[model samples]
Target: MDFKYVPTTCPYCGTGCSFNLVVVDGKVVGTAPFQRSPVNEGRVCPKGSYAHEFVNAPDRLKTPMIKKDGKFVEASWDEALDLVAEKFAQYKGEQSSVICCARASNEDNYALQKFGRCVMQTPNIDHCARLCHASTVAGLAQIFGSGAMTNSVSDLADTNCAFIIGSNNFEAHPLAGRRLMQAKKKGAKIIVCDPRRTPTAKQAHLHIQHYSGTDIALLNGMMQYIIQNGWENKDFIEKRTVGYEEFKKNVMQEKYSLENVSKITGVPVDDIKTACQWIHEAEKTTAVYTLGITQHTVGVDNVRSVGFLQMLTGNMGKPGTGVNPLRGQNNVQGACDMGALPNVFPGYQKVTDEAAVKKFEDAWGCKMPAKIGLTIPEMLDTFADEPEKLKCLYLMGENPIISDPDIAHVDKALKNIEFLVVQDIFLTETAEYADVVLPAVCYAEKDGTQTNTERRVQRWRKAQDGPGESKYDWQIIAELAAKMGMGDKFPWANASEVFDEMAALTPQYCGMNYERIEKEGLQWPCPTCDHPGTKVLHCETFAGMPDGKSVFAPIEHRPPAEQTDADYPFILTTGATIWHWPSGTMTRRSESLNRDCPTGWIEINEEDAAEMGIETGDIVTAYSRRGEVDVPARKTPDIKKGVMFMPFHFWECRANWITNTPYDPVSKTPEYKACAINVKKKEA
Candidate 1:
């Protein structure tokens, strides 16, 4: 038996730290973090350290299969690709859709995008960002020159203060949590403003549990405080930033006063003043947030509100000072950098723009659609009402059944598609309905690049071969292309050539080659052959404006789309547990992870438990207007009263079943955070 240690980035969260899989005798035994890696500093979250076990699980798909008479039967690659070609070829140049994932590596992502655009010829393609940060991207990109992190993780260590809103970093980005703790150790003041008492808030020097969906009120109030105190960095504001006086007049002189903000945000005036003081007086300050800020009816405005506050305080250029959006998945930043969105081409360029479309057309040797594509939520709306309906659905590496906001809608809307193809390593809940299942290689069995939360692209190395008859995704896609007479587009022999093509087409990745990333992974905006790649974007200017000035949009607080009502009197907040990734695709495959925590349970405060006549481990029925599911109740102090938390990793009990299907008007992202539901003791 022989083995090799290959250092690669994680496929889970966005830390992008290097790690090595213990490939013992041509099989991956375990994963260990790179001790010398600077990003993780020789540590990994529980998920990052153990997410490799699923590579060779017993339930892994071992052979390519086609659904014949409603049963998956093993077949040769030629037979499987022929079947896919027959179905997809029928939909070429039709109104079809391609839904991509952030978990996919760089080559895979680029291939999937090109497959949809060149093969399908529809701009109706989008990735998970449509669900997670579509609003955040639209929000921050409007203010900053680029829609990425303005400050890197290293800046957290160098900053004097951090203003966090609408996120639970402790459980979500645990590695970032350690850095937040580091900043606390270095005597940095942390101000957290959220409705829930999250782990990050518990560590904050000051925590303001503001009312849900009142982020704008809290931010506007803080801006007013800074103006009254005259603690703003006036010199930096005047020299670097534009539109200061008008922003001040609107934010400071508006009828929406601090008293009104205190009313809307449900925070004391003094507490708002204190938070404002820390941000205003700090020599260097940075603001950060996650999905909580972006998954809202006013998600776009919520992001701009934060950016406006930061620009007003002069937190843009210097170390420890800027707007940082804590990204969720490993390559979410990369997927966007590759133009996985419907509205934008690669590198965040608008698809409707003639120049951007012309660039992509020239590179791919095909004409692109002039209109932007549909988002997942928009696609859902089409399924909900429209007729021409999305046919021939091809889902790669995403499980919307367990991940989407509304479960009932997912079940019905997915039926609107004519032909369904699911390409993954495991038979995911969504894949259960697939007419064609292609057994594709997992991350450990494939080598490519993954961009982290900070837009840092790092090497993803393969440590083992695909078990049984499974093949790399590139091979599967190429064979399908060949069967459909588009094989010439994918002339590459390996994934490296795919990367070369992606870098050639996408300008942000233009300079990044396999050899370069092998030496040291290059972050996007590497733009040219010799560019070192941008560490922090917009160091000298913001996006949109000619002189690079941030725009301040007028905003106000609104209640969550679905608040606690009489029938369903509790507020349900959904999130992922430490041991579970989205839908538990890889996490559920692990023996240790399952043993640590299994099954979904509604968290009840000790007092709320008593009031509801619910005890620990009591099987209860959680119901809403959309749907219902039964789960045991767990009373814990981690959550506040009247608010129940549930992990969305399990499929048998889909969390989205009970979630409201409220969408943000601007971001079009479903509001998965706040929903009204009732929990009761399950009848015997």
Candidate 2:
């Protein structure tokens, strides 16, 4: 028995934990800890431990398939690629769109985006980041000139106070949560702001249970109280930030008073004051949040409010202080860095910038589009409304049918597309609608790099061979580009060569190479060969502004896009569970994870359940303006009254069916956290 352990990064969450894939006789069988990892230090979450289970699952996509007579039939790579290339050739510029994958490697994303711009001559490219951290990218860029987590993940352990809002890190991002636990063990104060009494909230010294869509009000109230008591860091604000007077005037308004904010957020005035006091008293405080803060109509406002609170308290540039928006997927950060978004090229370079476009065009030997492209929601909307305008879509590794808001509408939009090509390791729900389905390799069978939430760039070492006929995502893209007469533009021999080309174009990754990050990974802003990676941003000066100071946005609270009515009297929110990852593509295939959470359920407050004659385990029908779903009811006091919670992992009870479609104007992120719904016990 030939056995060996291969160290690689976890392909689950953005925490970027490392583990050794247990390979026996050329097959990945299990995972062991890699102690030298800087992120997890030999620790991993359940998803990471069982990540290998899905690689060799029984239903793995082994060959390419093409839809014939409304049913899929196995086909050779030449036949599928020829058909795809022929169909794609019919659509050019804005008529085509490409959806990259966050779960794929950085090399794959960079090559795919280059294909979209140079070969397809279209800027309509994006990934799951639009659904998760688009607000983080937009809001932080406006305030601090950067749109990523400002501090390292391990820095959380050194924080004196951690203000965790909108995210339950203990369940959503376990490894990062472990850092907060370490801080707690060292006497650091842990303050959580959330409506549900999550495990993380229960462990907090203070849990401010604010209502959904009221983040701006809660943050404004805290800032108001801080300024009123003269607890704010005036020196820091005056020296390191601008627009203080206008921001102060806005937050100091009587409408944002403690009592008013309490009425709006459902959080008591005393609890709000206590949270503010803890943050002010701590020497180093970090503001941590996730989708609960970004998946709203005011997502950008909410994120900017968090930045305001941190900057107001002089917590911008220290080791244990900064606004940290933990990414949901393994390589969502890397995907964004590789220019998977519509508006920017790699390294956040604007697509409209002539210089940047010229540089890429010269490098690729092709002219590129200068116009910014549509986001995921916008693409779907265009497909549904004007299918002729955006006719074809090339989606890789994304399951938008279950992940997008108002999936009922998503289903309609997908059906209207002229042509759809899906590339993945499985025949996902979304892939079922594809004209062609291409089998792709998973992380364990690929050699690449992934950027974590803290801007750390880590390596993913290949441990085993891909299933039969399955190809790397970049390889498929390159072959298609070759078929379309752009083979010269993609002449890389391996993933490392692809990385070298990408690093040459991206300023942030200009110095990064495979040799430099072979063992422990290096964080971004490592702009030179000899320079150490950056751990904290904006130390002496803000990078976003020309004046070297952060700017404050004077934002006011706005209610959710869809408010509760007499017919729909409850607020419904969607999220992920600890057992399964998003869309349940990989995790659901894992026997252990599937056994733990075999189905979906809605969390209802005990009082509400009792009032509606609903009991735990009872089938409940939840109805919204958009759609309805029947899920088992879980009556618990952990969730606030007048609100219901459901995870989006189960396809049988898709939470997105009832989620609101209205998105943030700035971030284009749907308001998944606040939608009006009505529920009742399902009759037999």
Candidate 3:
């Protein structure tokens, strides 16, 4: 029996844990711990352990298919590519949009975005980051001149204090949560601010159960108390930051006082003070958060407020300090870095910048569009409201039907499009509406690189051969580019060639090569061949600002787009579970993961469930202004009363069906964390 272990990064959350794929006689069978990996330190979460189960699942898409008579029919790759190319030729400029995938490798995203610009000649390109961390990119860039995590995952162990808010990293990002525990073991204080008493919160030294949509209020209150007690880092603010005078004046207002903030956030004034005191007392305080802070109408404001707090407390630079926004997917950070967004080229070189456009044009031998394109939300809105504006959409490895807010509207937009194409390992709900469906290989069957949440670029080594005619994402894109008459621009022979081409153009990755990161990944800003990767950003000075000093944005708290009222009396929020990842595309395919958490359920406070005569496991219907869903009820005192929690992973009970569509003006991130909803027990 020929057996070998192949090392690759986990394809789940952004924690970037690495494991060895157990291959038995040339087939991937299971996973084993890779002790040398600094990310997970030889330990992995349940999802990582079971990640290989879905790679060779029976339902893997093996052949390309084309729609005929409103039904899918197997076809040769040439036939499907011909049809796609024909359809794509009809839509040009703003009429065409490309939705790249976060699950795909950096090579895949870079190729797709390049194809969109040179072949289709459209600026409409984006991925799931617009929904998850667009605020992190926009908000942090405005403050610190960069939108990525300022500290490495391993740095959490060196923190003196960890101020966690709006994230249940213990479940969503287990490996990252492991780092927080390491800090605790070293006598570090953990302060968690969340509405639910999550496993992470339960382990906190101080848990401030704040109300939903009140992150700004809670943060402002803490800052006000810190300043009132003369704990603010006046030296850092005066030397390393700008706009502190206006920011101080804004937070010192009576509305931000501990008493008013307590009323707004439903967190006790003393608890708020305690949180501030703990942060001030600590030598190094790190602010940690996730979608809970970035999935609201005021997501940018919330993120900026966190940045302001860190800068005010002198936590901008050094180990175990600065703001950390954990990404949701394995390559979501890579997707953004590869310029899969609407407004920027690779390395965040703005499309509007003539110099950046000219550089790319000279490199690719094509005239690129200079105008900013539509984001994901804007693309969907155009599809639903003005179908003619965006006639064709090419989606690769993205399941927007289940992942996007107001999925009902997403369903409509998918159907309304003139031409739709989906490429994935499986026929997702979003692919069911596709005119052409291309089969793509999973991470185990592809050789490429994926950038984790910390800007670390790691290699994804191919462990086994893909089933049937399925091809690598970049290969499929290259083939389509060839058919679309841009073969000269995409002359790369393999993933390495693609990476070399991308690194040459993106300044942050210019120093990295496959050889340098063969065993262990390296973080970004490796600008030279001999330069070591950066672990902590802003070590000496901020990079995002032109003046080498961070700026402050004095923001005020804004209520959620939809408020609780007589019709919808409870606040509804959504998140992921420990056993399953977002949308349940890969996790649900794992028999073990599916068996553990079979379906979705709504978590109602025990008091609220009791008042409604509802029992655990009882069927309940949650109603909002847009839509409603029937799900099993789970009564738990861990959750606050007047608030409902649901995991948006199950299709039978989609939480996004009732999620509000109002998005942040700057980031365009939908308000998935807070909305108005009412729940009632289903009668027999």
Off by over 4 Å in 2: none
- Give lDDT tens digits, candidate 3, residues 1-684: 999999999999999999999999989999999999888999999999999999999989999999999999999999999999998998878899999999999999999999999899999999999999999999999988888999999998899999998999999999999999999999999999999999999999999988899999999888888899999898998889999988989999999999999899898888988888889889999999999999999999999999999999999789999899999999999999999999999999999999999999999999989989999999999999999788999999988888999988998889999999999999988899999999999999989999998889998999999999999989999999899888888998999999999999999999999999897989998999998899999988897799989998678999999999998999999999999988888999999999999999999999999999999999999989989999999999999889989999999999999998999999999999999999989998
Q: Scored by CA lDDT, what does every candidate get?
A: 0.79, 0.94, 0.93
| Error in Å for residue 225 of model 1 | 1.7
* Model 1 / residue 63 / CA error / Å: 1.6
Residues 392-497 of candidate 2 have per-residue lDDT tens digits of: 9999999999999998899999999999999999999999999999999999999999999999999999999999999999999999999998898899889999
Report clashes for each candidate as comma-separated counts: 3, 1, 1
Listing every candidate in turn, what is its Cα RMSD in Å to the true structure after a full C-alpha superposition? 1.9, 0.7, 0.7
Candidate 1 ranges beyond 4 A from true positions: 92-94, 243-246, 253-256
Q: How high is each candidate's TM-score?
A: 0.96, 0.99, 0.99
**Model 2 TM-score?**
0.99
Summing lDDT over every window of 10 consecutive residues in candidate 3, give the lowest-scoring window.
268-277
User: For residue 30, what is the lDDT in candidate 1?
Assistant: 85
